[model samples]
Target: MAPRRCPCGTGLTYDGCCGRLHDGTATAGTAEQLMRSRYSAFAVGDPAYLLATWHSSTRPGRLELDPDVRWTGLEVLGTTGGSLLAAEGTVAFRASRLDDGVPGVQAEDSRFVREGGRWVYLDGVPLR
Candidate 1:
C-alpha cells in the first residue's frame, strides 16, 4: 500500500512531509508549516507533538484531544510573516472533520512565534 498524503494539503507523502516533523526529525520552517504539522498532530492524535510545538507563553497546562473527532481535510487560506528570520506570523486555514459521523469544520487564523530558534504555535482566533 502506498503511504498516505499529508493532511496539510502539501501534496506530499505523510512520511516525507508532516510525519518527519511529528517524529522530531525535522522542524517547521514557517508558520504555515507549523500549522500543517499541528493539524497532522490532531489527525494522528499525538498530543505530545501538539504541546511540544506550542509556544510556552500560551501553552495550556494540559491538552485534551477529542477522540471522537476524525479529521478529514485541510485548506490553507493565507499566511503572513513567519519566515526563518521573522519573529511572528499567522496562518489562516479550514480543517474539516467528523464528529462521531457528523461533519464539521474548524476555521481559524492561527498565530505562531519562534521560541528558542524554532517555530511554535501561539494561538488561534476563530474565523466565524
Candidate 2:
C-alpha cells in the first residue's frame, strides 16, 4: 500500500495516524479505539498489527498488501455492545480506498470477538 492522506485530509501517512496504538501505546482503551487503530493499520499496510490484534481463532494465516492501493479515510458509522469481557460484538464503518486508477469504498458490518484481553476481528458483511 502506498502512503496516502488520512481521514483528516492531512497529507500525513496512516502510520502516523494510529500506528502508535499498535506500538505499545496505551491510547486504545476501548473496542472503538482499537477499531480505529486497526483501520489505520490497514491504511498503512501494517499487517503485523492486524495479525497481532486478531484473535487466533479467526485470524487469517497471512495478509497480502496491494502495492498500488492507498487508503484515504475511515468512518465509524456505528458500534454495538462488545464489552471488555464479551465474547462477541459488531462494528459498522466505511473504509475508502484508491488503486491509483479508481477509487472505491468498503462498507462493512464487522464482527469481533474478545479472547483473553484482546479484541480480534472476525468476518464481516460487506455493504458494497
Question: Which candidate comes out best when scored by lDDT?
Answer: 1
lDDT of 2 at 83: 64
Q: State the lDDT of candidate 2 residue by residue for 1-128, as single tens digits.
A: 78755543335654565656667664444566667778877776788888888878778899887878888877888888766656677888888899886898889988877667667777789876
Q: Taking the tens digit of each residue's C-alpha lDDT, what string does model 1 give over 24-125?
A: 999998888999999999998999999999999999899999999999999999999998789999999999999999999999999999999999998999
TM agreement with the true structure for every prediction: 0.96, 0.78
Instruction: Write down the worst ten-residue block by lDDT for model 1.
Output: 2-11
- TM-score, cand. 1 vs. native: 0.96
User: Residue 86, candidate 1: how far off, in angstroms?
Assistant: 1.3
